[model samples]
Target: MLSWVPLLTVALLCWIFSAGQPYGLPIAVWAEDSSSLARQLVRMLDATPGLSVRAQLLSRAEAQQALQRMDVYGVVHIPPHFARDVQRGGAASVTLLHNAQLSTASSLVQRDVRQVVGTLSAGVEMQAMAKRGTPAQALQVRLEPIRTQLVALFNVSTNYEQFLAATLLPALLHILAMTAGAWSVGRELRDGTLGQWLGAPAGEAQAPARPSAAQVLAALLGKLALPLVSLWLCGMAGLVYLSQLRGWAVAGSLAWIALGLLLLIAVSLAAGALLAAGTLSLRQAMSGAGLLSAPAFAFSGVGFPLLAMSGSARTWAEAMPYTHYARLQIEQWQMGAPPAQSLPVIAVLLLATLVLLALATAALLRAWARPQDWGKR
Candidate 1:
């Protein structure tokens, strides 16, 4: 199941979000002004990427009806005497009446509409304030006196596919890695084979034949080694596909990303193994792994900003390995941030993996020494 699920998910998501950004979202304009300025606004709105001025309604009532019928995301009402009001420095407000239900589409419409109106308003304001000058001077006055240029970085285009899907694939893989690790360890406990797997026995052997510490460690490693390699390769494969075949650019060192992903897989596996060893019950361990990893993405600040989260919620997010990996992935994949910026996060994942491995080792050692704790369905 793990082998093919990631493959299918990657394909499905890439296909679904193939268009990097939303485009041609339908909207209507309510032109109560019936003036040249109003028509110019409509043309500009239609020209903006991801927006289409589909209708020119005569009244707010007609626009609202179109909205209700799901014919458009929202409407822009050019208020009566808009041109005269602007010419007279009235600061006329072009109202954006939009359906909030479809927030994404609505936001796009709102942005484009606001930009068009703002541009037009600036030209009117600049002309009203000063006499004609050289075209360059006029352009500078219009831009400087009335409005400021806004530049969005990293995700300048606001490509949802790049923003979400790139990190999503790794987050999903982390969940699977943890679950598989729990199943590997928990199954031994469930079948009463913890001692055998740890190179101990049904009961502790007399000191001479007993498993040495190195032997015990080797035994566990031998059991999980294949799964560890397989899962890590899957992660690398997904990344390669996205960067190479899918046309997503890798902005930073692929080495940094590869290292981070490897650590995350190890950390997840160790956490799951620890959970299984601590619980000594297959079902409980698996459930615990899911409980820990499943909801972590939400807290990782992917869909929401970390700065906006409440103190306790932010604290919780910082405690998860997935959060660090997600941050590291974005730093390297999208931001192409300096290598130094990601060093601390990578260290955290490495430290977490080590700690979890130690804890799991201790738990397994305890479980192995006490055979009676095994066979707990």
Candidate 2:
């Protein structure tokens, strides 16, 4: 029972963190000269659910200073002629100074500000049309000369959970598979039983029976079997249980997701085998796996766009197995992309697994031939 505490604790924390999405954030408003229309705009901004007019600044300098101090995420600046321009039926503009360092929060603030400005502009236009004897029924149509409706395909509500959970959960499972596979080899070496485990003679015999390449590969695969199976189970749970609970899109067939999960596990296992064979020590193997897998979540393009990354960074991200897996999940679940789109991603994963497996097998065979290399580190 005590052993279950850490696992339960992790599950609890993930649940708590993901339960509520924060859409509304406080913002500062600075309207120069404080005209009636400016005040009305501020009120409208305050009423918006995405933003709260927490502070009314008298000067731009004060707003800038507050932003610098991190006291506010963004500042809305209404110019001196803002009201006069509106009343005269002239074009008016409001500038938003936002903290680009916090991309997500800044985006929310920008969206809310745009919505408020559009509403105010439409109202001013409708009043102007009324003065020209436009009928009341025509006024509404004139206010919105053109109407546009936005429909999000996969995530209807654009929920954060849908975006975050799908990527994060799979990445977490991949890390666990890597750790477990690495630990299996490390434990045998640390216990001074690796030679016996590999069926190779310890020291003494000049030409001890060296295991064939096939045998070496089999040994590594045997160690990985359980971890791979466990990872598959975890993948199924995320698809059937977590997806249903969170209302995440699962447009692709379950068979495709399962196949992708298998490839993901195979990649992790092959990576772990290569690390163990190269390092030849339990501690070093685990350390190497940690270094390789820790940044997978960020590089998977979950929080940011891959196109924005530099060439070198993008190349590195593409090499990660999780990056391919995440892309497949998004296409299948969210976009409901056709098989033509998804098959390429699955093919890439399969190719990676084969390459890594070959490398790991060769490394293990070399380690088996040279008994002195056992626990070399």
Predicted structure with the largest lDDT when compared to the true one = 1
TM-score of model 2 vs. true structure: 0.83
For each candidate, what TM-score against the reference? 0.81, 0.83
| Residue-by-residue lDDT tens digits, candidate 2, 1-377 | 11233234335535754754665588998888478888899999999988888898988789989899988889999998888888887888899999998988888888888989989888888878888999999988767779899877667766666677656767877777777767877776666566677765565322367777777778777878877876767666666654676556478765677788889878987887788876778788889889888899888888768889999999999989999998888888877777678898889889988888788778766665665655544
Clashing pairs in 1: 24-50
Q: Which residue runs does candidate 1 get wrong by more than 4 Å?
A: 31-40, 54-71, 80-91, 99-104, 122-143, 146-153, 191-196, 199-213, 246-248, 335-341, 369-377
- TM-score for candidate 1: 0.81
lDDT of 2: 0.77
Alpha-carbon runs more than 4 Å astray in model 2: 1-21, 33-36, 80-85, 140-151, 200-208, 281-284, 298-315, 338-341
lDDT for 166 in candidate 2 is 59
